[model samples]
Target: MGIFQRLMKNKELIPLAIIMTTAVAGASSFALYAFQKTDVVIDRKRNPEPWEMVDPTQPQKLITINQQWKPVEELQKVRRATR
Candidate 1:
């Protein structure tokens, strides 16, 4: 029998085609998912969400005893001592 006839009548080709199609579909799906980034940041400052956590970078306003306005914009400083 010719090669084409043999392949056409072969029972194994059906399973092989199914396997190849499944592999291609899975790879395409994975590639699509990999390109999508789910990180979305939403600022709630204008809405003033009561349950939302506050960012420490906002300036803390302080008042001195001498009636002076002191804005203490303190960012937690990490100091490493040299050996």
Candidate 2:
């Protein structure tokens, strides 16, 4: 007999088969979404070219304090020095 005929012959298994199919489909879709690669940022400057590089001669830019920032208690200066 065909698979459909076999499935129909067993009424009790219909719900089970449906649940399993749904679970599998849901898991597969979630897996596909979770494992998909993120958008890549490509550096096209030296594609198929000779490799030549140099160390940075200057320091990186300094970060300035934001006006809206607040300091936490742990970072605050201690009022009394401990022995």
Tell me, by lDDT, which candidate is best. 2
Worst 10 residues of 2 by lDDT: 50-59
User: Over 4 Å off in model 1, which ranges?
Assistant: 1-8, 38-83
- RMSD to the hidden true structure, all candidates: 18.2, 16.5
> Model 2, 35-67: lDDT tens per residue?
442322134464432222211332222553433
Using TM-score as the measure, the top candidate is: 2
Displacement of the residue 69 alpha carbon in candidate 1, Å:
33
How big is the RMSD of model 1? 18.2
Q: What's the residue-level lDDT of 46 in candidate 2?
A: 42
Off by over 4 Å in 2: 37-83
CA lDDT of every candidate: 0.53, 0.55
TM-score of 2: 0.42
lDDT of 1 by residue, 3-80 (tens): 558668996787777798899999999777654422222444654543234333432234434354443535212212
